[model samples]
Target: MIKDELRRGIIHENPILVLALGLCPSLAVSTSLQNGFGMGMAATFVLACSNVIISSMRRIIPDKVRIPCFIVVIAAFVTMVQLIMKAYLPALDKQLGIFVPLIVVNCIILGRAEAFASKNSISKSLVDGIVIGLGFTFSLCILSIIREILGSNKLLGLKFFPGYEPMTIFILAPGGFFTIAFVMAVVRYLGNRRKGA
Candidate 1:
């Protein structure tokens, strides 16, 4: 049962590819593997910590002000992650830039608080957060990999095909848009088939 919650986050309620939440980071920071990893990890840390804290405080939080409370909690954690990244991983910090701060508004974090963490046990909420965070991370990584390989003809800055010309478009902002859109379409198609079968 606990494992199922984690699985649901990755596939059923996927923050990016499925629910279409957090697309800003999904498209923006995915230009390189390092950027994607940094954004993903930062998001994961925020999501997991926020969920645990919110789940623990659910009963005491007034319904009318719950949204504000969740934002405060999420922002605090996002700031902490931002500082840690800046201090420990300066290069990645530079690569991610504004997206790190923007994690405060990433819908996946607040959505979990309102949809899952508020009602679930602390342990379950923690698992859900981890799973969802990983799902988002994996989705960005895969999309970046596809774009980088096809658009740049390189992986991690080492040329995979030195002889071939890079597509260039895959590395541009427009490429990111179409790549994710295409991937999401494929995911929805497969999801529908699975349900039908």
Candidate 2:
């Protein structure tokens, strides 16, 4: 059961690549490895904390007001993340900007709250959050790697191949879309091939 959940989170239901939950920030902050990882971690922390809260309060959170309640919980966690980032990771905090606070409305968190966390046990919800969060990070890392390497000719701000001309396009919005679409197509192709085998 745990293995299936892990697999689902990493591949079958990846929040960005598979489920396509958080694309706006993914495209925005994935220009570099630092930004990608930073945003991913911030969202991960918020998702995990919010999941635990929502799962524990599932029974008492009235259905009519549950959405607002979930947002409140998520917002609280997002605020906590902002404070921590501002205090310790100011550079990253600045880099991520509004995207950090935007995690409050991230569909991944809300979707998990309504679809999985709200209905599952605290332990399961917690695992789901971490797993899905990691999946989100993984997608960001992939995009960041491609963009940083080809678009900027650097990795984590250090040039990989000295004097190489950067594509520039990969660091822009169109490049992000192209990269994501290509990655999705490749993923789907692999899945189909595996099933055929």
Candidate 3:
């Protein structure tokens, strides 16, 4: 059962590539590997922690006010992550900018809180958060890698192909859209092939 859930989160129902949730940060932070990685980790931490807390308090939270309650819980976690990042990883904090605080409003987090965590067991919710976060992280990393390599001619700030002129456009907003569309096309092809088989 857990295996199925993990698979669903990571591949079948990926928040970014499949479900298309949380695209704002995904596009905005994926210009570089560092930004994407840092943003992803921050989001993962908040998602996992929020899921556990919300799941535990599911019964006590009033249904009418659960949305606000979830927001408060998620905001607390986001603030904690922001402080820790500012203290320990200031460079990354600056790189991610307002996106970290914006995690409190990420659809994926709140969607999972309302759709899964509130109705699931603590352990299952935890697993769901982790795997879904992993999916988001993986998607971000992949997009960042492509963008970095094409836009900056480097990976993780390391120049691989010397003398290679980078394409400035690939690092821009249009680049993010193009990269996502390409990935989605590939995913669709694979899904269709699997269904046909």
Candidate 4:
């Protein structure tokens, strides 16, 4: 049922935290809440639109060439978001930088198209896309929250722990690695425990 797919997308098969599909942007843009939210929005838009398109054209698309078609559709959506963000959300557009364009290569988008959208109805595919996208967003936001808080001693630019010296390294590339890995471990461990029970 749709509910099952939705649940799986968020936790059982989480794009960022569990499956580790879109780590590049998850790490790169998660230094701040604004950047994390922007990246999540862009990715969600692309995933939702692309899933619908792919579901509609599923029967016509040849399996051998489906990968390229999915990429084209995903890229088109990505470009649309990039243009809109550049014009409207210029600050976030600048913060995301090359990663926005690089979203075309994100495995989560293509994986969904191949794994779900191609076989499911348009509505189901759309829901799956949104659920999975939100899951990815949730993971990124959690990681960014921790990184932003510890690295800068602030949450959404408000200093929460006054007098606490921020760990400057947590905002850097190495910090992203550690933060994501640690978060992934926790998610995986919890998921396994739940499954075992």
Candidate 5:
């Protein structure tokens, strides 16, 4: 059912914390909540739309060339998103920069296209895209919360404590790995505990 699928996407098969897909963008844009949310939403739009289009055209697409077809579909939606962002959210577009265009090759989107969307019905693929996209967004936001707080000592640009020394490392690549590793470990521990019960 859709409910179970939703649960799995959010927990069991999260694109970042579990599936470990799309790690590059997650690391690059997760330094701030604003950037995280923006990237997540943009990717979600492309994923969902591409999933629907691919699922609908799955049978007609030649098996050997299906991968390229999926890329074309995903890239088309991504272009739409890029144009929309440039017009309405110029600063965010500038901040996201190349990663926005790089969504064309995002494994989360392409993986879903190959592994799920192509084989599933349109409705199922759409649901998968939405839930998985949301899972990606949720993970990015959580990571951003940790990074922004520790690295900048602020949330949404409001200072949490005056004159507190922020750990600048959290904004760097190593810190991204550290934060993701810690979160993944905690999540696995909880999952094991639940299964043992």
Candidate 6:
């Protein structure tokens, strides 16, 4: 059961590719591998921590104010993550900028909180957070790699080909859209093929 839940998040229901949640960060911070990775880790930490707390306190949280409660919990975690990042990873923190604080409103985190965490056991919710966080991180990494490589002819800030001209568009807003569209198309194609099989 646990294995199935984990697989579902990573493959069957990826937060970005499959579910299409949290696209703002997906497109913005994905300009580089480091940015994507740092953002992912920070969001993952919040997600996991929030899930555990929310799940454990599910009964005490009144249904009428559940949404507000969730926001407060998520925001607390986001603030902690932001402070920690600022302290230890200031460079990456600056690169991510507003996106770090924006994690408080990330649909993926809230969605999981309401849909799974509030109704499930602490152990299950924890697993859900970890798996879903991994899925989001994986998607960000893939998008970042494609954009960085094509847009700058570099990977992790290392030049791939000194003489090659990079397509600057791939790192811009349009590039993010194009990359997402291409990936979604490929994912759809693979899903169709799997269904047919």
Show how many residue pairs clash in every candidate, following the order shown.
0, 0, 0, 0, 0, 0
Q: TM-scores of the models, in the given order?
A: 0.89, 0.92, 0.91, 0.88, 0.93, 0.92
- The digit string of per-residue lDDT tens for model 5 on 87-181 reads 99888778776678878978999999999999999998999999999899999999999999899998887887788899999999889999999
- Lowest summed lDDT across 10 adjacent residues in model 3 is found at 92-101
Off by over 4 Å in 3: 1-3, 88-98
- Give the distance in Å from residue 63's predicted Cα in candidate 6 to where it truly belongs: 0.8
* Tens-digit lDDT string for candidate 3 (129-155): 998998888889999999999999999
Task: Put down candidate 2 lDDT per residue, 51-147, tens digits, no spaces.
Answer: 9999999999999999999988888878877898899988877888778877876788899999999899999899999989989998999989998
**Model 1 lDDT per residue over 1-197, tens place:** 75786678778888889999888767777777766777888789788999999999999999999999999988888888788889998987787767878789888889999999999999988988899999989888888888888888878877777688888888888999999999999999999999999
Better of 1 and 4 by lDDT: 4
Question: Which is the winner by lDDT between candidate 4 and candidate 6?
Answer: 6
Candidate 2 structure lDDT: 0.88
Error of 2 at 163 (Å): 3.4
What TM-score does prediction 5 earn? 0.93
lDDT per residue as tens, model 4, 1-197:
76787788788889988788988778788998867876787788788889999999999999999888888888888888889989998887787767788679888889999999999999988998899998888888888898999999888888979799999999998999999999989988988899899
| Model 5: lowest-lDDT 10 consecutive positions | 93-102
List lDDT for all candidates, in order: 0.86, 0.88, 0.90, 0.87, 0.90, 0.91
Inter-residue clash pairs, candidate 2:
none
Higher-ranked by lDDT: 2 or 4: 2
> Candidate 5: deviation at residue 28, Å?
0.4
Clashing pairs in 1: none
